[model samples]
Target: MPDGPHTAPAATPPLCEEEIARFVVERFLPGVDTGDLDPEYDLLATAVIDSLGVLHIVGWLSKQYGIVLPDRELASRNFRSVRTILATAERAAAVGAQP
Candidate 1:
């Protein structure tokens, strides 16, 4: 059988806190000013992210980072705020990138 096309690995775009914040604003809280989003804002407590919203976020995170989020990891704590979400995404990406 012929081997897969021998192409070099594609470059991964940089992941930054600003990007995460922007994504949150655009995806979850559309029409909200990006500057108003606090990194420590409690999305769940404030009703910004509900049960269905969490599913949307999980789907976005999976497709965006190419990482799989286990059912157990989908806790309020992990999706508490922009900072927490970024941390979770980075960790998941790292784990997924490993052999």
Candidate 2:
């Protein structure tokens, strides 16, 4: 008991990969089992998410990250897999954080 401020280090926000995976599993999947949706799995080919789901995911991402994703950037190449989504989110976050 010899501390003045007793301040703790600030915690960093989750990385892109972590954010994307957590959002998908927790928000998108809801009650469904997430065992089948591997991080590296092909979201489109495997039908893990459909068109409407994509929109939902995009909206969720925008809302959660405070980044608006245009439709042109909402292609399969950007949101096809977890890795891609992570990359996209990272880029968006970087840009959004810029003054």
Candidate 3:
């Protein structure tokens, strides 16, 4: 991934957790219904996101949100569940938007 700040088109919609869940469910965690996804479930513990999944998600996030998730924030806790992922994503975007 690029080490510099990221940017997107002005009309691109902001990041949404639903999109994230959709991507994960459709790509990595099929057979799992997003409607029943627990916000606090430990995704890594259940193998929902393996190493490859991590790279995929991080890449997708960077492209979609135009944010660089700092190396320190790549830990399991931040990506633990639906809620945490959304929170971490929002934080990254917010920080990246700063001047």
Q: Global lDDT for candidate 2?
A: 0.73
Which candidate leads in lDDT? Answer: 1
Full-model lDDT, candidate 1: 0.81
Q: lDDT rank, highest first?
A: 1, 3, 2
Q: For residue 25, give model 3's deviation from the true position in Å.
A: 0.5
Per-residue lDDT value at 6 in model 1:
78
Residue-level lDDT of model 1, residues 1-99, one tens digit each, is: 558867887875566667677878997889999888999999889998888877877887776667677776788799888888888878877877889
TM-score of each: 0.77, 0.67, 0.77
Candidate 2, which segments miss by more than 4 Å at Cα? 1-15, 27-37
Model 1, stretches more than 4 Å misplaced? Answer: 1-13
Tens digits of per-residue lDDT, candidate 3, 24-99, equal: 7888777988777767778889998877777778888888767789997787778877778888888887888889
Model 2 TM = 0.67
**lDDT comparing candidate 3 with the true structure:** 0.79
- CA RMSD for every model? 4.2, 5.1, 7.6
Alpha-carbon shift of residue 64 in model 3 (angstroms): 1.6
